[model samples]
Target: MWLLLLLPCVRADSRCKSDLISSINITAKLQSDILLPCNFELTLFKSDMTADIASVWRESPCKSELVLSLNVTTALQSDVLLPCNFSPGLIGLNTTADIAAVWSHRNMTVNNLVEITLQGQTMYWKNYNRQIKTFSSVSASGNFSILLRNVTQSDEGLYQCDLFNGTGCRIAYQEMHLRFDDSPADGFLTWLVTAGALGGGVVLLVFLITIYICAKRSTNSSNESVSRELYPPEVPHDAVEYTLENPIYDAAVQSETHSSFRAEKGNSAETAVYTAVKKVKRKERKPEEVQ
Candidate 1:
Protein backbone atom coordinates (compact mmCIF):
# COMPACT_ATOMS: atom_id res chain seq x y z
CA MET A 1 0.00 0.00 0.00
CA TRP A 2 2.90 2.46 0.77
CA LEU A 3 4.63 1.52 -2.48
CA LEU A 4 1.47 2.33 -4.46
CA LEU A 5 1.30 5.78 -2.82
CA LEU A 6 5.01 6.45 -3.49
CA LEU A 7 4.69 5.63 -7.20
CA PRO A 8 2.56 8.70 -7.94
CA CYS A 9 4.88 10.91 -5.92
CA VAL A 10 7.90 9.61 -7.87
CA ARG A 11 6.17 10.27 -11.18
CA ALA A 12 5.21 13.79 -10.11
CA ASP A 13 8.76 14.48 -8.97
CA SER A 14 10.11 13.33 -12.31
CA ARG A 15 7.63 15.54 -14.18
CA CYS A 16 8.69 18.60 -12.14
CA LYS A 17 12.37 17.86 -12.76
CA SER A 18 11.73 17.72 -16.51
CA ASP A 19 10.44 21.33 -16.52
CA LEU A 20 13.94 22.69 -15.86
CA ILE A 21 15.21 23.17 -19.39
CA SER A 22 18.15 25.49 -19.74
CA SER A 23 20.91 27.23 -17.75
CA ILE A 24 23.17 29.80 -19.45
CA ASN A 25 26.26 31.83 -18.52
CA ILE A 26 27.48 34.81 -20.46
CA THR A 27 30.47 37.22 -20.30
CA ALA A 28 30.41 40.67 -21.87
CA LYS A 29 32.68 43.68 -22.10
CA LEU A 30 32.28 47.11 -20.57
CA GLN A 31 29.86 49.50 -22.25
CA SER A 32 28.80 46.75 -24.66
CA ASP A 33 25.49 45.13 -25.46
CA ILE A 34 24.64 41.60 -24.34
CA LEU A 35 21.68 39.21 -24.37
CA LEU A 36 20.71 36.54 -21.82
CA PRO A 37 18.65 33.87 -23.48
CA CYS A 38 15.82 31.83 -21.86
CA ASN A 39 13.48 29.84 -24.02
CA PHE A 40 10.83 27.19 -23.19
CA GLU A 41 7.82 25.46 -24.76
CA LEU A 42 4.27 26.09 -23.52
CA THR A 43 2.54 22.97 -24.89
CA LEU A 44 1.03 21.75 -21.61
CA PHE A 45 -1.11 24.85 -21.11
CA LYS A 46 -4.32 24.70 -23.15
CA SER A 47 -5.48 27.75 -25.11
CA ASP A 48 -9.23 26.92 -24.75
CA MET A 49 -8.97 27.38 -20.96
CA THR A 50 -10.28 30.63 -19.58
CA ALA A 51 -7.90 33.37 -18.55
CA ASP A 52 -8.52 32.49 -14.89
CA ILE A 53 -7.28 28.95 -15.41
CA ALA A 54 -4.65 29.60 -18.03
CA SER A 55 -1.90 27.68 -16.20
CA VAL A 56 -2.15 23.87 -16.49
CA TRP A 57 0.13 23.53 -13.46
CA ARG A 58 -2.69 24.94 -11.34
CA GLU A 59 -4.72 21.72 -11.77
CA SER A 60 -1.76 19.36 -11.28
CA PRO A 61 0.35 21.67 -9.02
CA CYS A 62 4.07 20.96 -9.44
CA LYS A 63 6.88 22.11 -7.13
CA SER A 64 7.73 25.81 -7.30
CA GLU A 65 11.51 25.26 -7.16
CA LEU A 66 11.99 24.72 -10.93
CA VAL A 67 14.19 27.72 -11.74
CA LEU A 68 16.46 28.51 -14.69
CA SER A 69 19.83 29.76 -13.56
CA LEU A 70 21.75 32.27 -15.67
CA ASN A 71 25.02 34.01 -14.87
CA VAL A 72 25.89 37.16 -16.84
CA THR A 73 28.91 39.42 -16.46
CA THR A 74 29.08 42.96 -17.84
CA ALA A 75 30.63 46.30 -17.01
CA LEU A 76 29.14 49.61 -15.98
CA GLN A 77 27.27 51.72 -18.51
CA SER A 78 26.21 48.70 -20.57
CA ASP A 79 22.97 47.72 -22.20
CA VAL A 80 21.65 44.25 -21.38
CA LEU A 81 18.72 42.25 -22.74
CA LEU A 82 17.26 39.62 -20.44
CA PRO A 83 15.33 37.25 -22.69
CA CYS A 84 12.28 35.14 -21.81
CA ASN A 85 10.39 33.64 -24.72
CA PHE A 86 7.82 30.89 -24.86
CA SER A 87 6.57 28.94 -27.90
CA PRO A 88 2.90 28.00 -28.20
CA GLY A 89 3.76 24.47 -29.29
CA LEU A 90 0.50 22.49 -29.21
CA ILE A 91 -1.76 25.47 -28.67
CA GLY A 92 -3.59 26.34 -31.94
CA LEU A 93 -2.48 29.48 -33.74
CA ASN A 94 -6.04 30.85 -33.84
CA THR A 95 -6.59 30.50 -30.09
CA THR A 96 -5.29 33.12 -27.65
CA ALA A 97 -3.48 32.44 -24.34
CA ASP A 98 -3.05 34.75 -21.40
CA ILE A 99 0.52 35.10 -20.03
CA ALA A 100 2.17 37.72 -17.85
CA ALA A 101 5.89 38.42 -17.30
CA VAL A 102 7.35 40.40 -14.39
CA TRP A 103 10.98 41.53 -14.19
CA SER A 104 12.42 42.31 -10.78
CA HIS A 105 15.80 42.92 -9.14
CA ARG A 106 16.40 40.61 -6.20
CA ASN A 107 18.52 42.92 -4.07
CA MET A 108 17.92 44.40 -0.63
CA THR A 109 14.55 45.44 -1.98
CA VAL A 110 12.74 43.13 -4.39
CA ASN A 111 12.24 46.00 -6.75
CA ASN A 112 9.91 45.30 -9.67
CA LEU A 113 11.09 46.94 -12.85
CA VAL A 114 8.29 46.15 -15.30
CA GLU A 115 5.22 43.99 -15.85
CA ILE A 116 4.00 42.89 -19.28
CA THR A 117 0.63 41.28 -19.97
CA LEU A 118 -0.10 39.41 -23.20
CA GLN A 119 -3.89 39.73 -23.09
CA GLY A 120 -4.34 43.43 -23.85
CA GLN A 121 -0.67 43.83 -24.84
CA THR A 122 -0.20 46.18 -21.89
CA MET A 123 3.10 47.12 -20.23
CA TYR A 124 3.32 48.66 -16.76
CA TRP A 125 6.61 50.15 -15.55
CA LYS A 126 6.92 49.83 -11.80
CA ASN A 127 10.23 51.57 -11.10
CA TYR A 128 12.64 52.13 -14.03
CA ASN A 129 10.53 53.30 -16.94
CA ARG A 130 13.16 55.38 -18.65
CA GLN A 131 15.93 52.81 -18.32
CA ILE A 132 13.87 49.72 -19.20
CA LYS A 133 12.54 49.02 -22.69
CA THR A 134 10.92 46.13 -24.51
CA PHE A 135 9.81 45.18 -27.99
CA SER A 136 6.38 46.31 -29.15
CA SER A 137 5.53 42.83 -30.47
CA VAL A 138 6.20 41.11 -27.12
CA SER A 139 2.74 39.52 -27.13
CA ALA A 140 2.82 38.59 -30.82
CA SER A 141 6.33 37.15 -30.84
CA GLY A 142 6.02 35.69 -27.32
CA ASN A 143 9.22 37.49 -26.50
CA PHE A 144 9.31 39.01 -23.03
CA SER A 145 12.88 40.26 -23.30
CA ILE A 146 13.55 43.43 -21.32
CA LEU A 147 16.31 45.79 -22.40
CA LEU A 148 18.18 47.60 -19.66
CA ARG A 149 20.02 50.71 -20.88
CA ASN A 150 23.08 52.33 -19.32
CA VAL A 151 23.34 49.87 -16.44
CA THR A 152 24.89 51.26 -13.30
CA GLN A 153 26.79 49.78 -10.35
CA SER A 154 23.52 49.48 -8.45
CA ASP A 155 22.38 47.12 -11.19
CA GLU A 156 24.97 44.56 -10.13
CA GLY A 157 23.10 41.69 -8.48
CA LEU A 158 20.61 38.98 -9.20
CA TYR A 159 17.67 39.65 -11.52
CA GLN A 160 14.59 37.48 -11.88
CA CYS A 161 11.90 37.06 -14.49
CA ASP A 162 8.72 35.36 -13.44
CA LEU A 163 6.03 34.25 -15.89
CA PHE A 164 2.58 34.00 -14.40
CA ASN A 165 -0.81 32.91 -15.60
CA GLY A 166 -3.96 34.96 -15.20
CA THR A 167 -4.53 33.15 -11.89
CA GLY A 168 -1.29 34.71 -10.54
CA CYS A 169 0.48 31.35 -10.30
CA ARG A 170 4.14 31.42 -11.50
CA ILE A 171 4.55 28.76 -14.22
CA ALA A 172 8.08 29.59 -15.34
CA TYR A 173 11.01 31.24 -13.54
CA GLN A 174 14.48 32.55 -14.50
CA GLU A 175 17.17 34.32 -12.48
CA MET A 176 20.37 35.96 -13.64
CA HIS A 177 23.49 37.31 -11.90
CA LEU A 178 24.74 40.61 -13.31
CA ARG A 179 28.20 41.77 -12.38
CA PHE A 180 30.86 44.27 -13.48
CA ASP A 181 33.58 43.08 -15.83
CA ASP A 182 37.17 42.68 -14.67
CA SER A 183 38.26 45.96 -16.23
CA PRO A 184 41.43 46.31 -14.22
CA ALA A 185 43.00 43.40 -16.04
CA ASP A 186 42.20 44.98 -19.38
CA GLY A 187 43.64 48.30 -18.19
CA PHE A 188 46.81 46.60 -17.03
CA LEU A 189 47.22 44.87 -20.38
CA THR A 190 46.74 48.12 -22.25
CA TRP A 191 49.25 49.87 -20.01
CA LEU A 192 51.72 47.09 -20.54
CA VAL A 193 51.49 47.43 -24.31
CA THR A 194 51.84 51.20 -24.21
CA ALA A 195 54.84 51.07 -21.91
CA GLY A 196 56.47 48.41 -24.04
CA ALA A 197 56.11 50.52 -27.18
CA LEU A 198 57.45 53.62 -25.44
CA GLY A 199 60.44 51.77 -24.05
CA GLY A 200 61.24 50.25 -27.41
CA GLY A 201 61.13 53.65 -29.10
CA VAL A 202 63.44 55.11 -26.46
CA VAL A 203 65.88 52.25 -26.88
CA LEU A 204 65.88 52.66 -30.66
CA LEU A 205 66.52 56.41 -30.37
CA VAL A 206 69.44 55.84 -28.02
CA PHE A 207 70.93 53.28 -30.35
CA LEU A 208 70.69 55.61 -33.36
CA ILE A 209 72.28 58.46 -31.41
CA THR A 210 75.10 56.20 -30.32
CA ILE A 211 75.73 55.09 -33.88
CA TYR A 212 75.75 58.70 -35.16
CA ILE A 213 78.23 59.79 -32.51
CA CYS A 214 80.54 56.85 -33.19
CA ALA A 215 80.40 57.46 -36.94
CA LYS A 216 81.28 61.17 -36.49
CA ARG A 217 84.22 60.36 -34.26
CA SER A 218 85.51 57.76 -36.69
CA THR A 219 85.29 60.21 -39.62
CA ASN A 220 87.23 62.88 -37.67
CA SER A 221 89.95 60.35 -36.71
CA SER A 222 90.27 59.14 -40.31
CA ASN A 223 90.57 62.73 -41.64
CA GLU A 224 93.25 63.57 -39.09
CA SER A 225 95.30 60.47 -39.92
CA VAL A 226 95.01 61.10 -43.70
CA SER A 227 96.07 64.81 -43.32
CA ARG A 228 99.14 63.87 -41.28
CA GLU A 229 100.21 61.28 -43.87
CA LEU A 230 99.64 63.56 -46.93
CA TYR A 231 101.00 67.03 -45.80
CA PRO A 232 103.87 66.37 -43.41
CA PRO A 233 105.26 69.46 -41.55
CA GLU A 234 108.61 70.96 -42.87
CA VAL A 235 111.70 71.14 -40.58
CA PRO A 236 113.99 74.31 -40.92
CA HIS A 237 117.83 73.81 -41.57
CA ASP A 238 120.67 75.94 -39.88
CA ALA A 239 122.76 77.93 -42.56
CA VAL A 240 126.17 77.59 -40.71
CA GLU A 241 125.72 73.89 -40.12
CA TYR A 242 124.79 73.36 -43.79
CA THR A 243 127.81 75.36 -45.10
CA LEU A 244 130.34 73.63 -42.75
CA GLU A 245 128.99 70.23 -43.68
CA ASN A 246 129.21 70.94 -47.48
CA PRO A 247 132.85 70.95 -48.93
CA ILE A 248 131.97 72.61 -52.36
CA TYR A 249 130.33 75.65 -50.67
CA ASP A 250 133.27 76.20 -48.25
CA ALA A 251 135.95 76.06 -51.05
CA ALA A 252 134.03 78.55 -53.30
CA VAL A 253 133.81 81.17 -50.49
CA GLN A 254 137.60 80.85 -49.65
CA SER A 255 138.68 81.42 -53.31
CA GLU A 256 136.56 84.60 -53.62
CA THR A 257 138.09 86.07 -50.35
CA HIS A 258 141.76 85.34 -51.40
CA SER A 259 141.33 87.08 -54.79
CA SER A 260 140.01 90.27 -53.11
CA PHE A 261 143.06 90.35 -50.68
CA ARG A 262 145.66 89.99 -53.51
CA ALA A 263 144.17 92.92 -55.45
CA GLU A 264 144.70 95.26 -52.42
CA LYS A 265 148.33 94.06 -51.86
CA GLY A 266 149.30 94.79 -55.51
CA ASN A 267 148.23 98.48 -55.17
CA SER A 268 150.39 98.86 -51.97
CA ALA A 269 153.45 97.32 -53.71
CA GLU A 270 153.37 99.95 -56.58
CA THR A 271 153.52 102.89 -54.12
CA ALA A 272 156.58 101.46 -52.23
CA VAL A 273 158.61 100.95 -55.50
CA TYR A 274 158.39 104.72 -56.38
CA THR A 275 159.62 105.69 -52.87
CA ALA A 276 162.75 103.31 -53.21
CA VAL A 277 163.93 105.08 -56.41
CA LYS A 278 164.15 108.51 -54.57
CA LYS A 279 166.21 106.93 -51.86
CA VAL A 280 168.71 105.59 -54.54
CA LYS A 281 169.38 109.16 -55.96
CA ARG A 282 170.42 110.45 -52.54
CA LYS A 283 172.92 107.60 -52.14
CA GLU A 284 174.57 108.49 -55.58
CA ARG A 285 175.19 112.18 -54.49
CA LYS A 286 176.93 110.96 -51.36
CA PRO A 287 179.40 108.81 -53.44
CA GLU A 288 180.40 111.86 -55.70
CA GLU A 289 181.38 113.96 -52.70
CA VAL A 290 183.66 111.23 -51.47
CA GLN A 291 185.51 111.00 -54.81
Candidate 2:
Protein backbone atom coordinates (compact mmCIF):
# COMPACT_ATOMS: atom_id res chain seq x y z
CA MET A 1 0.00 0.00 0.00
CA TRP A 2 2.76 2.45 0.90
CA LEU A 3 4.67 1.30 -2.23
CA LEU A 4 1.63 2.02 -4.51
CA LEU A 5 1.46 5.59 -3.23
CA LEU A 6 4.90 6.08 -4.73
CA LEU A 7 4.27 4.51 -8.19
CA PRO A 8 4.66 7.30 -10.71
CA CYS A 9 2.39 7.78 -13.72
CA VAL A 10 4.43 8.96 -16.69
CA ARG A 11 3.68 12.41 -18.16
CA ALA A 12 2.08 12.76 -21.63
CA ASP A 13 5.62 13.32 -22.96
CA SER A 14 6.00 10.70 -25.75
CA ARG A 15 9.62 10.35 -24.68
CA CYS A 16 8.70 9.30 -21.13
CA LYS A 17 6.07 6.59 -21.69
CA SER A 18 8.14 3.40 -21.73
CA ASP A 19 7.54 0.34 -19.53
CA LEU A 20 10.24 0.34 -16.82
CA ILE A 21 9.95 -3.35 -15.86
CA SER A 22 12.26 -6.05 -17.21
CA SER A 23 12.03 -9.85 -17.40
CA ILE A 24 15.13 -10.29 -15.21
CA ASN A 25 14.52 -11.38 -11.61
CA ILE A 26 17.05 -10.70 -8.83
CA THR A 27 18.15 -12.68 -5.78
CA ALA A 28 19.64 -11.40 -2.50
CA LYS A 29 20.88 -12.41 0.93
CA LEU A 30 18.34 -13.15 3.66
CA GLN A 31 17.13 -11.29 6.79
CA SER A 32 18.74 -8.00 5.87
CA ASP A 33 17.84 -4.63 4.40
CA ILE A 34 18.18 -5.63 0.75
CA LEU A 35 18.66 -3.76 -2.49
CA LEU A 36 16.21 -5.27 -5.03
CA PRO A 37 16.99 -4.55 -8.63
CA CYS A 38 13.92 -3.79 -10.83
CA ASN A 39 15.29 -4.35 -14.31
CA PHE A 40 16.03 -0.93 -15.81
CA GLU A 41 13.09 0.47 -13.80
CA LEU A 42 13.42 1.86 -10.29
CA THR A 43 10.75 2.29 -7.62
CA LEU A 44 9.62 5.88 -8.16
CA PHE A 45 6.63 8.00 -6.99
CA LYS A 46 5.37 11.46 -7.89
CA SER A 47 3.03 13.63 -5.77
CA ASP A 48 2.20 15.50 -8.98
CA MET A 49 3.10 14.60 -12.56
CA THR A 50 5.19 17.82 -12.79
CA ALA A 51 7.48 17.29 -9.80
CA ASP A 52 11.18 17.01 -10.55
CA ILE A 53 11.54 13.54 -8.98
CA ALA A 54 10.12 11.39 -6.20
CA SER A 55 11.92 9.70 -3.28
CA VAL A 56 13.11 6.07 -3.78
CA TRP A 57 13.85 4.58 -0.33
CA ARG A 58 10.25 4.42 0.74
CA GLU A 59 9.06 2.93 -2.55
CA SER A 60 11.26 0.10 -3.97
CA PRO A 61 9.65 -3.36 -3.76
CA CYS A 62 13.10 -4.94 -3.53
CA LYS A 63 12.75 -7.81 -1.09
CA SER A 64 15.55 -9.74 0.59
CA GLU A 65 15.03 -13.40 1.49
CA LEU A 66 12.14 -13.63 3.93
CA VAL A 67 14.02 -16.61 5.31
CA LEU A 68 16.70 -15.47 7.76
CA SER A 69 19.92 -17.34 6.87
CA LEU A 70 22.15 -15.13 8.98
CA ASN A 71 22.04 -11.52 10.14
CA VAL A 72 24.85 -9.08 9.13
CA THR A 73 25.77 -7.41 12.39
CA THR A 74 27.28 -3.90 12.27
CA ALA A 75 27.48 -1.12 14.85
CA LEU A 76 25.07 1.77 14.56
CA GLN A 77 26.47 4.95 12.95
CA SER A 78 29.11 2.74 11.35
CA ASP A 79 29.48 2.67 7.57
CA VAL A 80 28.31 -0.48 5.82
CA LEU A 81 28.30 -1.76 2.27
CA LEU A 82 25.51 -3.85 0.76
CA PRO A 83 26.84 -5.52 -2.35
CA CYS A 84 24.61 -5.65 -5.47
CA ASN A 85 26.07 -6.51 -8.85
CA PHE A 86 23.88 -5.76 -11.91
CA SER A 87 25.55 -7.96 -14.48
CA PRO A 88 23.63 -8.07 -17.77
CA GLY A 89 24.24 -11.80 -18.10
CA LEU A 90 21.23 -12.36 -15.86
CA ILE A 91 18.95 -11.56 -18.81
CA GLY A 92 21.23 -11.24 -21.84
CA LEU A 93 21.37 -7.44 -21.97
CA ASN A 94 22.63 -5.81 -25.17
CA THR A 95 22.98 -2.16 -25.92
CA THR A 96 23.91 -0.31 -29.15
CA ALA A 97 25.33 2.62 -27.21
CA ASP A 98 26.72 3.18 -23.75
CA ILE A 99 24.63 2.08 -20.74
CA ALA A 100 23.68 4.14 -17.69
CA ALA A 101 22.65 3.19 -14.12
CA VAL A 102 20.05 4.31 -11.59
CA TRP A 103 19.88 3.19 -7.97
CA SER A 104 16.80 3.37 -5.75
CA HIS A 105 16.02 2.52 -2.14
CA ARG A 106 12.45 1.26 -1.64
CA ASN A 107 10.39 3.27 -4.20
CA MET A 108 12.11 6.62 -4.76
CA THR A 109 14.38 7.95 -7.44
CA VAL A 110 17.89 8.18 -5.94
CA ASN A 111 19.27 11.21 -7.73
CA ASN A 112 22.51 10.81 -5.82
CA LEU A 113 22.88 7.32 -7.31
CA VAL A 114 21.71 8.26 -10.81
CA GLU A 115 24.09 7.80 -13.70
CA ILE A 116 22.51 9.13 -16.92
CA THR A 117 25.10 7.82 -19.32
CA LEU A 118 26.79 4.49 -19.18
CA GLN A 119 30.39 4.92 -18.05
CA GLY A 120 30.01 8.63 -18.79
CA GLN A 121 29.20 10.70 -15.70
CA THR A 122 27.48 10.36 -12.34
CA MET A 123 25.08 12.83 -10.70
CA TYR A 124 24.97 12.70 -6.92
CA TRP A 125 21.58 13.15 -5.22
CA LYS A 126 21.83 14.17 -1.59
CA ASN A 127 19.28 12.97 0.98
CA TYR A 128 20.68 14.12 4.27
CA ASN A 129 24.28 15.08 5.06
CA ARG A 130 25.03 11.32 4.77
CA GLN A 131 27.31 9.99 2.04
CA ILE A 132 25.65 7.29 -0.04
CA LYS A 133 27.36 6.35 -3.27
CA THR A 134 27.81 3.63 -5.86
CA PHE A 135 31.28 2.27 -6.31
CA SER A 136 33.33 3.51 -9.23
CA SER A 137 34.67 0.00 -9.67
CA VAL A 138 31.14 -0.97 -10.66
CA SER A 139 30.96 1.80 -13.25
CA ALA A 140 34.04 0.55 -15.04
CA SER A 141 33.66 -3.17 -14.41
CA GLY A 142 29.84 -3.47 -14.55
CA ASN A 143 29.54 -4.38 -10.87
CA PHE A 144 26.89 -2.06 -9.47
CA SER A 145 27.62 -2.01 -5.71
CA ILE A 146 26.52 0.96 -3.56
CA LEU A 147 28.07 2.24 -0.35
CA LEU A 148 26.15 3.56 2.65
CA ARG A 149 28.12 5.81 5.01
CA ASN A 150 27.27 6.58 8.64
CA VAL A 151 24.13 4.47 8.54
CA THR A 152 21.12 5.05 10.79
CA GLN A 153 18.00 3.02 11.73
CA SER A 154 16.09 4.67 8.94
CA ASP A 155 18.60 3.42 6.40
CA GLU A 156 17.93 -0.26 7.10
CA GLY A 157 15.73 -1.35 4.19
CA LEU A 158 15.69 -2.87 0.70
CA TYR A 159 17.79 -1.40 -2.10
CA GLN A 160 17.68 -1.66 -5.91
CA CYS A 161 20.37 -1.28 -8.57
CA ASP A 162 19.10 -0.87 -12.13
CA LEU A 163 20.87 -0.51 -15.48
CA PHE A 164 19.67 1.58 -18.41
CA ASN A 165 20.69 1.89 -22.02
CA GLY A 166 21.25 5.14 -23.90
CA THR A 167 17.55 4.99 -24.89
CA GLY A 168 16.57 5.08 -21.21
CA CYS A 169 15.58 1.41 -21.31
CA ARG A 170 16.19 -0.35 -18.01
CA ILE A 171 18.17 -3.61 -18.51
CA ALA A 172 19.42 -5.34 -15.34
CA TYR A 173 18.25 -5.98 -11.77
CA GLN A 174 19.90 -6.86 -8.39
CA GLU A 175 19.11 -6.43 -4.69
CA MET A 176 20.72 -6.80 -1.22
CA HIS A 177 20.09 -6.07 2.47
CA LEU A 178 22.23 -4.32 5.06
CA ARG A 179 21.43 -4.04 8.76
CA PHE A 180 23.26 -1.98 11.36
CA ASP A 181 23.02 -2.79 15.05
CA ASP A 182 24.83 -1.99 18.30
CA SER A 183 27.85 -4.17 19.00
CA PRO A 184 31.15 -3.81 20.87
CA ALA A 185 34.38 -3.54 18.86
CA ASP A 186 36.58 -6.64 18.83
CA GLY A 187 39.76 -5.25 20.42
CA PHE A 188 41.54 -8.61 20.47
CA LEU A 189 41.23 -9.09 16.72
CA THR A 190 42.65 -5.64 16.03
CA TRP A 191 45.64 -6.19 18.34
CA LEU A 192 46.27 -9.65 16.93
CA VAL A 193 46.35 -8.40 13.34
CA THR A 194 48.76 -5.60 14.23
CA ALA A 195 51.11 -7.91 16.13
CA GLY A 196 51.02 -10.53 13.40
CA ALA A 197 51.89 -8.02 10.70
CA LEU A 198 54.82 -6.65 12.73
CA GLY A 199 56.13 -10.11 13.51
CA GLY A 200 55.95 -11.19 9.86
CA GLY A 201 57.80 -8.09 8.70
CA VAL A 202 60.58 -8.54 11.31
CA VAL A 203 61.06 -12.19 10.41
CA LEU A 204 61.25 -11.36 6.70
CA LEU A 205 63.92 -8.71 7.30
CA VAL A 206 66.06 -10.99 9.45
CA PHE A 207 65.87 -13.80 6.93
CA LEU A 208 66.96 -11.52 4.10
CA ILE A 209 69.96 -10.23 6.11
CA THR A 210 71.07 -13.72 6.98
CA ILE A 211 70.88 -14.80 3.35
CA TYR A 212 72.90 -11.78 2.19
CA ILE A 213 75.71 -12.33 4.71
CA CYS A 214 75.99 -16.01 3.89
CA ALA A 215 76.12 -15.26 0.18
CA LYS A 216 78.85 -12.64 0.72
CA ARG A 217 81.01 -15.03 2.76
CA SER A 218 80.55 -17.80 0.23
CA THR A 219 81.55 -15.47 -2.63
CA ASN A 220 84.67 -14.26 -0.77
CA SER A 221 85.83 -17.82 -0.08
CA SER A 222 85.27 -18.78 -3.72
CA ASN A 223 87.38 -15.83 -4.91
CA GLU A 224 90.21 -16.70 -2.54
CA SER A 225 90.27 -20.29 -3.75
CA VAL A 226 90.35 -19.15 -7.37
CA SER A 227 93.24 -16.74 -6.64
CA ARG A 228 95.26 -19.46 -4.92
CA GLU A 229 94.70 -21.83 -7.85
CA LEU A 230 95.66 -19.23 -10.47
CA TYR A 231 98.92 -18.16 -8.73
CA PRO A 232 100.81 -20.83 -6.80
CA PRO A 233 102.42 -19.78 -3.45
CA GLU A 234 106.21 -19.32 -3.66
CA VAL A 235 108.54 -20.83 -1.00
CA PRO A 236 110.72 -18.22 0.85
CA HIS A 237 114.42 -17.93 -0.33
CA ASP A 238 117.03 -19.46 2.01
CA ALA A 239 119.36 -16.96 3.86
CA VAL A 240 122.95 -17.67 5.09
CA GLU A 241 124.62 -16.40 8.31
CA TYR A 242 128.47 -15.74 8.30
CA THR A 243 131.01 -15.10 11.12
CA LEU A 244 133.88 -15.15 8.51
CA GLU A 245 133.17 -18.91 8.48
CA ASN A 246 131.61 -19.04 5.02
CA PRO A 247 134.25 -19.20 2.20
CA ILE A 248 132.35 -16.72 -0.07
CA TYR A 249 132.40 -13.96 2.63
CA ASP A 250 136.11 -14.51 3.47
CA ALA A 251 137.11 -14.49 -0.21
CA ALA A 252 135.26 -11.21 -0.85
CA VAL A 253 137.10 -9.50 2.08
CA GLN A 254 140.57 -10.79 1.05
CA SER A 255 140.04 -9.85 -2.62
CA GLU A 256 140.42 -6.13 -1.68
CA THR A 257 144.13 -6.79 -0.74
CA HIS A 258 144.96 -8.27 -4.20
CA SER A 259 144.83 -5.66 -6.93
CA SER A 260 145.71 -7.92 -9.88
CA PHE A 261 142.96 -10.43 -8.92
CA ARG A 262 139.76 -8.61 -9.86
CA ALA A 263 136.51 -10.14 -8.53
CA GLU A 264 134.63 -9.50 -11.78
CA LYS A 265 131.57 -11.71 -12.29
CA GLY A 266 132.89 -12.67 -15.81
CA ASN A 267 136.44 -13.43 -14.67
CA SER A 268 137.89 -16.96 -14.42
CA ALA A 269 137.59 -18.67 -11.02
CA GLU A 270 140.70 -18.61 -8.69
CA THR A 271 141.15 -20.41 -5.36
CA ALA A 272 142.01 -18.42 -2.22
CA VAL A 273 143.52 -19.70 1.07
CA TYR A 274 142.88 -17.79 4.35
CA THR A 275 145.42 -17.79 7.28
CA ALA A 276 145.56 -15.36 10.26
CA VAL A 277 149.00 -13.78 11.16
CA LYS A 278 150.19 -11.12 13.75
CA LYS A 279 150.61 -7.57 12.40
CA VAL A 280 154.33 -6.61 11.77
CA LYS A 281 156.04 -3.34 10.49
CA ARG A 282 156.93 -3.70 6.82
CA LYS A 283 160.51 -2.38 7.38
CA GLU A 284 161.18 -4.80 10.26
CA ARG A 285 159.72 -7.67 8.22
CA LYS A 286 161.94 -6.64 5.27
CA PRO A 287 165.17 -7.42 7.36
CA GLU A 288 163.88 -10.87 8.22
CA GLU A 289 162.85 -11.48 4.62
CA VAL A 290 166.44 -10.49 3.34
CA GLN A 291 168.04 -12.88 5.88
Tell me the lDDT of candidate 1: 0.67
- Leading candidate by TM-score: 1
Tens digit per residue, CA lDDT, model 1, 1-291: 999999999966755555656777799999999988866577643454345465554554223343578788876787987776655631125325666678889989888888776653545655587898877475555567788899998988998877776566666777888878857877898899999999999999999999999999999999999997876544221221212244444434533434444344553434433434454566668979999
Best model number under lDDT: 1
| lDDT, residue 126, model 1 | 54
CA-lDDT, candidates in order: 0.67, 0.54
TM-score of every prediction relative to native: 0.41, 0.33
RMSD of model 2, in Å?
Answer: 21.1
Q: Kindly list the per-residue Cα lDDT of model 2 for residues 1-291, writing each as its tens digit.
A: 765654543234543666555566667778868776554323444445324443453343232222112234566677777565544543234433466656666634433355534453666666532476655644554665556788778666666666655454555555655566545465666777999999999999999999999999999999999998876454221221224335555444555443233433333224432321211233348778988
